[model samples]
Target: MSQQDARIDAYIRKSASFAQPVLEHMRALVHKACPEVEETIKWGMPYFTYKGQLFCCFAAFKAHCSFIFWKGALMDDPDNIFQQRGENGMGQLGKITSLKDLPSDRTFIKYLKAAATLSTSDLPPATKKAAPVKKALEVPDWLLSAIKKNKKAWATFDAFSYSNKKEYVDWIVSAKTDATRDSRLADALTWMAEGKIRNWKYVK
Candidate 1:
């Protein structure tokens, strides 16, 4: 038997009048297609899990709703119901504003069963994203000389992390005009002397 969550009922009730029916219909299909599916909230939205793996989830926005399969990229989408990559909604069915926006009941249930099976199968692991490469920071000769003239600023800058130092160097180098560069460099030095980072105003 599938476990039904009361919060999901409340969630549907709280959704906009247009979205409530769409969400309720989607939820029912998920349960009907997978009798063993477990219901819970993840990331502030309703999710259906199977065999301790994420099967699918749905979200209700102000004007629309979306149903997303966890292994969407691996799913066999012969019907092309899945949205194109990088579209407005990352959901498989795109922005579902009404019941008509969804596929037929039979097609939707088939998708849910396929998703449930994939969740318990030995699916390939998701690829990991590589960490961004940090570029080297080069201090300008004039800027370096100016900082060196102030002992307090020099000491503060010397102890800064690579990111903190890069912030100042990038700000000075990105100036469009020589006067702007000089002005920013002067401000950098004054701030450093007071033991402040380049974006000190935003720091808590």
Candidate 2:
């Protein structure tokens, strides 16, 4: 088993009763169908990967869990086991609370195998391309001056990721007035100098 599998197994071992068996069963089915599937943790959830792409993931929550087939939109589900709750690039069958809520092991295994085959054999549709990251708002004159005045903050902000930079800029630009913007900028510069993202301290 891969390190990710071990970690997932550990998670299941400590999870609430309703989640344990569900995740364990899904884990078994995934490995059985795709013997070469590698495991990894993504966004703090267990994910299985094959052919350089993620195949599927199972996540546990307070009341239910979700089985997400990454390329599920491409598969033909004759039994309608793949639930279509929203948009279609991925498919989810959630609110799974017990073993009986799942499709038969054999059927679920087939879905996993088919999903893996589709991911390996075909190019994803245009809608599946990763979305471009949004740009930050233009830096205001005052905010620019603050950064220039603080050498350490200027250096830190320059090295921030596009998303991080956008967060700081948006926070300041969203202020209702120049006075509010100026007040926020002072605190923003102090946080940036410490290499923190906007709202970093408040983020969970």
Query: Which prediction has the highest lDDT against the true structure?
Result: 1
Q: Give per-residue CA lDDT, model 2, range 69-104, as digits (tens).
A: 876766778888866733232336757888888899
Model 1 Cα lDDT, one tens digit per residue, 12-116: 899999999999899989989998888999888999998788888998998889988887767888777877532124487888899999999999999899989
lDDT on C-alpha atoms for all candidate structures: 0.86, 0.79
Error (Å) of candidate 2 at residue 22 is 0.9
**Clash numbers, per candidate:** 0, 0
Q: Each prediction's TM-score against the native?
A: 0.64, 0.57
- TM-score, model 1 to reference: 0.64
Error of 2 at 26 (Å): 0.7
Candidate 2 weakest lDDT stretch, 10 residues: 85-94
**10 residues in a row with least lDDT, candidate 1:** 83-92
